[model samples]
Target: MDEVEKNKTVEKDMKKLVNKSWFRYWLSAEMSNSYERLQSLSFCYSIIPVLKKLYPNKEEFGEAVKRHLNFFNTEPTWGSPILGIAIAMEEEKAKTKQIPGEAITSLKTGLMGPLAGIGDTIDWGTLKTIIYGIAVTFASSGNILGAFIPLVFTCLTFIIGRYLTNFGYTVGKDSVKSILQQGWIKELIFGTSILGLFMMGALTSNFVKIITPLSFEIAKGQTLVIQEILDSIVPGLLPLCAVFGIYYFLKKGKVNYGVLAIGIVAICLVASFVGVL
Candidate 1:
């Protein structure tokens, strides 16, 4: 085929690979999760259509499927972009027949960590907190606004997810070098982490309620309330302390979650029975 015809054929193939139906497949990217490879099976499943188009021979198609089915796991939301880029790279490999399976696998593995970090920081740490914060405020007021707000947020995220998938394919292999070399990914992670911490503090203060009812006679008639004294020193002092205590235990990693939960329940029950809380 002539150069122009080859270019036209590549464009047609790429257009076919990244269509509306393909985006639907990418959206179901986490449906086949497993403990062994996590999203590896679904990841392979998402790109099967592309693989079929690129690798005509049964042996080549099988090899391509196996190559993608190795080990793959990342945040499903932002990870769609990585999937798009991988599809483009696989297309190139099929055309040139030079890129080895190891190279492709290595690329996927290397990108997973960084992409997951970015995705978790943005999606879980920042965006989720913002959405939940707003929704909870409305729900606390006994309004349906909270439910509708989260539904809107979910729709917006779906659209953004689709866009990221297409963007990844559009950027192709440069997606890795561009993200790492430019250093913006690091800045994004740092910014989102700081925001997440601030949100966590706000949630703790608003939700965690702790107070003491103990009272002592200071002199002949004067009485001192322990909770009032603690509040005077710092509002939510007990709550802050409780949070830090739990954080300390969690950081230690020696205590199981179930044991910690039971311990907290036991402590609360004892304290209430003794009238200390």
Candidate 2:
């Protein structure tokens, strides 16, 4: 190989070499114990789709898949789709003679909106509402189902993601390009995302309830239970509304998360002090 080809070969080899370290870091499974690992791309699940191209053998693929699966204990909401994008990047790299700066830049830029849209839709909206509904159901029955909440979702993530990897890897480069280029597919992704958001909202509206005590002074002596008060707030609606309102304000004014968080804390504290929580 020419010197240029030699450098290219070396770069590919270095990427491969780094995968070993990345796999080891992921296998550590020390979430919340060492966030540095997560921050260091150890928690990056997006590397999976690309790995099939980089490593073709079943042994390498299986090992990489297992390592990726075992490596992170945190929620894989964004991680899964991020892995999808990584696969797309690798496919793009393989298709081009040289990595077009514009291509890479476009992918990066395009991912931002999709990532935010998907992350907020699935993680904050669909998954949380579903799991919360499940947990609250079990917990209300005094079964401590809330404790198993994270485990249940983790299993779910693995199951869904296994398919995503299978499909993305099997289809490889051309498929990814087609998925990206097709307007209908993009619409489908957004449409499903919207449906997920709506379903989550509807579920949360019906299932996620908060209770508190209240009294009707003008009428004959009446004790209004917390759930009843929630009915007045549009039938189990206020908490979600409150959160969305806060989120809206934060978005509208460009408020920092810290400030919003502090506002939330203050609201909680005040509510607690007043026995309204």
Candidate 3:
């Protein structure tokens, strides 16, 4: 092969070398969780193949393995970029002998927290919420296909995670740092937050039900109907108020979800019994 073609072939071969590592990571990202070490064991396990390949010498391989075994935990899917970058760093260290093992450990430790936050916000908070909300609508209408929506989304997540793994390996850490420096990640989080709020508002209006049978006697000849007044002022004011009240308390971070649910049921039962709702 010519020089250019030969270089391309070598690059492709190197990428293939890491595929086994990536696949292992994808399969066991959360399976071997531990309270103390968290995902460190799984993380080390995932990259063991690549580390073995890179550090063929027994002493070097042992040090590389030990470095990855340090406390490491992050969102499995979204945090995948860190794995890709780690692989790149490992490869560099093996080839150049300049990048220290401690640097690799520090890179992982530093990135995990930030990436975990972003992953939790986007994947768990926004994407899953939106998907499940749509699925719930289909489910409530008795569509059996709704049951498979989450499964489909889970598959999609795997595809996304795989793509990110390859992307991180291909692009390396400089690109990731550039993306973060440009504030794109923050904008993504904000946009998703707004979309999540919109979805929640839509769900609340569609599902939450509250009405009152309250009236006030202004005079013997004329009674002031509270429901009519509320309707005139706002069509679904009671439901809105109920949803906002619950949201406020939850945001305060002092309420347990189970307690809130039971309290709501009790309050609704009392209100209905009193003929006020």
lDDT of each prediction vs. the true structure? 0.76, 0.52, 0.79
In terms of lDDT, the poorest run of 10 residues in model 2 is 32-41
Off by over 4 Å in 1: 1-13, 19-26, 173-277
Model 2 misplaced stretches (Cα beyond 4 Å): 1-25, 28-85, 89-174, 195-209, 221-229
Q: Residue 83 in model 2: shift from native, Å?
A: 1.8
RMSD of 3: 12.8
The local distance difference test score of model 2 is 0.52
Worst 10 residues of 3 by lDDT: 183-192
lDDT by residue for model 3 over 163-193, one digit each (tens)? 8888888776454345445745445445545
In model 1, how large is the Cα lDDT of residue 251?
Answer: 89
Candidate 3 residue 245 Cα shift, in angstroms, is 43
Off by over 4 Å in 3: 1-6, 173-277
As for lDDT, the candidate ahead, 1 or 2, is 1
- Residue 131 CA error for candidate 1 (Å)? 1.1
Query: What TM-score quantifies how close candidate 3 is to the native fold?
Result: 0.60
**lDDT of candidate 1 over 55-100, digit per residue (tens):** 9999999999999897687887776777777887787678766556
Per-residue lDDT of candidate 2, residues 44-125 (tens digit): 3445545666557787566545444321223344434334444544545455523332333333333334444665688668
Pairwise lDDT winner, candidates 1 and 3:
3
